[model samples]
Target: MELDDLDWKILALLQEDGRMTFTELAKRVSLSAPATTERVRRLEAAGVITGYSATVDPQRVGLPIESIVRVRVRSLDTPRFRTNVLVLPQILGADHVTGDDCWLLRVVCRSMVELEQLVEEAQRYGDTTTSLVFSSHVRNRPVDISIFVGIVSR
Candidate 1:
C-alpha cells in the first residue's frame, strides 16, 4: 500500500502503543480523527498493517533464560518432527532462514537444566548452538518502515 509520511507516523505511533484512540492519533499525525481512522482502515485493508500484539517479559512468567538455538532440521515439512518438535514448552519461536542453519529458534527456560533439555530435544533434528541473552539491545521495537519497503504518497 502507498503510504505517506503521515501514514508512517501513524504506524510508528501504533507500534509503540496500539491502544491509542483515533483522536490522539489524529493529533499526532496532523489529520482529522476520521481521516486518521480511514487511513488506518485502508492500511489494514491493503495488508500493510498485519496485527497488534503485546510484548511480554519472559522472565516475569517464570522463564528467565533466553536462548537462541540454531537448528539444521533435516526437513521442516516432516510431520513427525513438526508435531513432536513443537510440543516443547521451552520453545518461544522457530523460524526458517537462508544460511547454514535451516531453523533459528528462540528458547525461554527456567534454568540451565531446562535449557540443556531443550537443546537435547532439538539435537535429534541437527546441530544446536545456544546463545544466552544477557541484555537485549533492542526491546521489541517497531520495524524501521523505510528500510525494507518504499513508501510514496500523494
Candidate 2:
C-alpha cells in the first residue's frame, strides 16, 4: 500500500477519467503501457482503486435537484432509526456526525414535490431540514501522496 508520486498522479488522472486506456494514461504520466497497467492493478489490489464509474450530469439524466437533508432523530438510542436511514434510495451520502443533528444526508430528487415527499417519509424516523445546494465548489479530490505515504509508513 506504499504509493509514490507516480501512483498518486495515476490515481488523480483516473479519478477524472476512469475509462482512460493504459496507453493514454501511460502517455500522460510518461510510463510504459505495461507499467501503467501494473500500477493501476496494484492500486486496485491494495484497495486504493475500488472501481471505475462514469460521471454523469444528474440534471442531464433528468434528476436536476440536488439537496442535503439534516435529520434529528427523537430516539437516538437504538438501531431502528439507523435501519431507516440506509433504506432511503434518494440519499447519496449519510453520516452520523459530531454536531447537533444525528444524521446529514446528500440527496438528489427530480422535483421539489419529490424532495418534499422524501423529507416527509424521513419524518417517521426524525425531523428533517431540507436545503437546496445551488452549486458544488468541489465534489471529490485527489489524495496527497505525502499524506498517503506518511499514513502507510506508520
For 1-154, candidate 2 gives per-residue lDDT tens digits of 7777788888878877888999999998899999999999999999999998766678898888999899887765337766765577778788888767878989988999999988887787777888899999988565544465433320
lDDT of 1 by residue, 1-154 (tens): 6677888888888987898999998998789999999999999999988987877899999988998988777774446556777678788787878888877888899999988887887787778788988888876677776663554322
Q: How many angstroms is residue 141 displaced in model 1 relative to the true structure, after the best TM-score fit?
A: 2.1
Error of 2 at 80 (Å): 3.1
**What local lDDT does model 2 show for residue 115?**
91
Local accuracy by lDDT, each model: 0.81, 0.81
In candidate 2, the residue pairs with backbone N, CA or C atoms under 3 Å apart (3 or more residues apart, or in different chains) clash, namely: none
- The 10 consecutive residues of candidate 1 with the worst lDDT sum are 145-154
In candidate 2, stretches whose alpha carbon ends up further than 4 angstroms from where it belongs are 74-78, 144-154
**Backbone clashes under 3 angstroms, per model:** 0, 0
